[model samples]
Target: MTGPVLYGIPNCDTVKRALAWLEDRGIEHRFHDFKKGGVPADRMDYWIAALGWEALLNRQGTTWRKLDDAVKAGVTDAASARAAMTAHVSLIRRPVVEWPSGEITVGFTHDSFKQHTREALM
Candidate 1:
């Protein structure tokens, strides 16, 4: 929001790679550690609106996989996903990045980061 904000657990491999990628490029950003602070409610709303809850939700993650079948089946929409993600921060996809230009990306890829950085600098 203020600069670029990267949100995820510090121990996640993807998060670590993303942090390294940003650092390698010297892209100044802020990291929000979900483990300690948890996801911000306001940002959750914004993320849902921007990318849809489907994009933000990580179905493949062990956290989601370990969830009860009932819980998995209950996530029918944004609100439901938000509830799950709120209760389990790990359910949200890794390294959700909020670019300064009001753009948001769920996961990191070198190409996407490159393009986003270019757009941000513009």
Candidate 2:
């Protein structure tokens, strides 16, 4: 309730770890499931502005690999990359965190989350 909102698939191991880490630290956060709710385009736009589409887009995932070479090849800039990610939401890297301090991050790390949360509550 007081911490950042965490977005990702429920089954992702990284998402599980991120949630566990927050729990262990007594950080209350809202979890948004991409599978059921889908990623909001405005949120994606914010992420693209903050971290860039390159980082937000998970090119290493099965989703990305399954994309046609042409689609993958077309992601040369933020707009194109966002289009690709929009078409395949699963191509987003797991655990995109929208910190309460108004910062948006693409992936998860316990230390990083802890630091950001602490700063936000300060």
lDDT for 72 (candidate 2): 84
Q: Estimate the lDDT of model 1.
A: 0.91
Off by over 4 Å in 2: none
Per-prediction TM-score, please? 0.94, 0.90
lDDT of 2 by residue, 6-80 (tens): 999999999999998888878888999988998888888888888877788898889988888998889899999
> Which is the leading candidate under lDDT?
1
Q: Write the per-residue lDDT of candidate 1 for residues 34-120, one digit (tens) a residue.
A: 999989999999999988999999999899889999999999999999999999999999899989988888888999888988987
RMSD vs true structure, all candidates: 1.2, 1.5
TM-score, prediction 2: 0.90
Every candidate's lDDT: 0.91, 0.85
